[model samples]
Target: MALGLKIVLTFCLSFSTLFPKPIVCLDPGHGTKNARHGCVDEAKVVLAVALELKEQLKQNGFEVVLTHNRLGQDLKAKNPDQDNQKRAQIANRAKAFLFLRIHTDSPSGVSAIYYPQTHPNRPLAQESQKAACLIWRQIKTVLPKTLPQGGVLPESRTKIGAQNGDLLVGSKYSRVPVVTIELVPMSKIGRDWIFQKKNQRLLAQKITQGICDYLYSQH
Candidate 1:
């Protein structure tokens, strides 16, 4: 009887360990007035992507949180990384498995940001870097190849490029693997092509696929 009980307990523990709770924090960068590009605000584009990503993740059995949803009360914060503290608090409490900051790029095109391996606050785990690379590669594979502007980005030499230096906060305070994806140029194409409703929806779908591939591959 004792032996049977031990075996059953061990089996249950293994099952639980193999299927740990998964949570994701999605942040939409920038706000309305001071967007990276004037055509479509970074806030608007990112929020669109975040909502779609949230839906996709939910379907895949993951809990999702958005740093700035439409119903959010306040968009203004004096802190450099405005919502970094709040994001970190939520992720820590939920024990998030991944943190993704989403934004639409300037007329420059698609790029993803990861904390350099040397960054002081970067998680010391090799697995986190591996996860970042996986997501980066997946996004690179799916974005429109016809556009010369989009591709995986080399790490920034200085953190300042991540927007007023506060950009580093995503990777810095992240307890789990973190990545920020700047998707496509807001103005490179013609006005009709650039702001077409269909194009934005397609972009969101591709991003959701990238995130799903990354997480599923690890399992």
Candidate 2:
């Protein structure tokens, strides 16, 4: 290589190493086709929350990537397993530091944090849980008491995951710290509060803070 070319390349490499922005992948789970909570589908609400969270994260000096094509685009899948894997692949290919899957649950559901099951062969399970706990703690401090908190839980603890050795497809395939935060239940109280514009922004701010806490702890 030419001497000047090599020097410029070396400088670029060093600069990137010192100032690389951490990449965060946000997967807004479910959509229009998803189960209807009252008048709105699950996807409609989650899309709103994810979009707000994306803006918040960007403002906090992180590069955020959405698995969907558009702001509220819902990716299609022929099968359930494929749908989950496709979402995880987007994060894996981006090599994101964290994969945050956002969703809302039924009336009885609690706002909870779920981490993947520990796997002897997979190194990230433990780290996933560690990150989850930190995010959970941070969120708890900010989220209002009106929203019920379910605390941190292993993936296996959930019903759907329990059938698969406690591992969700996304959780099993993710190469980075993966956590799911179910924001609210479908009940009247949960809906009225979460759907409010101010609350969505507040939720975004809180989630961003939680992510910030986990990222800082890593260093």
Candidate 3:
């Protein structure tokens, strides 16, 4: 490399390392490998929301990363457990402000937000709940009118985490605050206005509002 080029490259790397940008890692729930057939799958809808969220977050001045960057990501996958762990690892590697997973199918028939019941690091657990509450409030505003409101909850209290004593695989492996937002029951998802472009945009904006609140309030 030319002398001047090397100097510029070195300075850029140092700047990135010394004053790292705040990153938010988004996992767009399950993908094709686990997708439900004949319905608008959770993977497809969540990816759309995440893509919209990524743009909104960037406009608010935060760097964004995705665990499943695209729909094709799960095409060759065989192990769901390994996939979930890798999703958490992506957030850890990014050193994100938080790890937020987006999903549309909620068997519970309510809009719910879940945080780790007992993260190994006490502060992480607290931060996770705080963020979940902030996001949950915003999410409620955009939910279907008929959908019941499920308050921010500890993972252990929910049936979704039954396999792991109330802890989801992603939260179990995460090094930072992890939150999973389940939008609505899959049944409502198909008939509702959720997939409408206008509705999706509004939902993205509300979610962005919550994330910004949690991330910037501290500073």
Q: What is the TM-score of each candidate against the true structure?
A: 0.70, 0.83, 0.83
Which digits, one per residue and each the tens of the lDDT, describe model 3 over residues 63-174? 8998877776663445776677878988999999899988764544567889997878889999999999988877787677777767798988765577786788889999
Q: Compare the candidates by lDDT and give the number of the best one.
A: 3
Alpha carbon deviation, residue 34, candidate 3 (Å): 6.8
- Report the Cα lDDT for candidate 1: 0.56
* TM-score pick, better of 1 and 2: 2
Q: Which regions of candidate 3 are displaced past 4 Å?
A: 1-19, 32-40, 74-78, 189-191
Write model 1 residue lDDT over 144-211, tens digit each, in one string.
55544434442353234355344355566666666666666565552234355666556555555555
Q: Global CA lDDT of candidate 2, please?
A: 0.74
Prediction RMSDs, each to the true structure: 8.5, 8.6, 8.6
lDDT of 2 by residue, 1-219 (tens): 346334433443344367787888998775523221323456777788889999877766678898773433345655566677878999999999899998776788788889986644355887788778877775676566777879999888777688877887778778888998888776777888788989888778767767776666665
- Candidate lDDT values, in order: 0.56, 0.74, 0.76
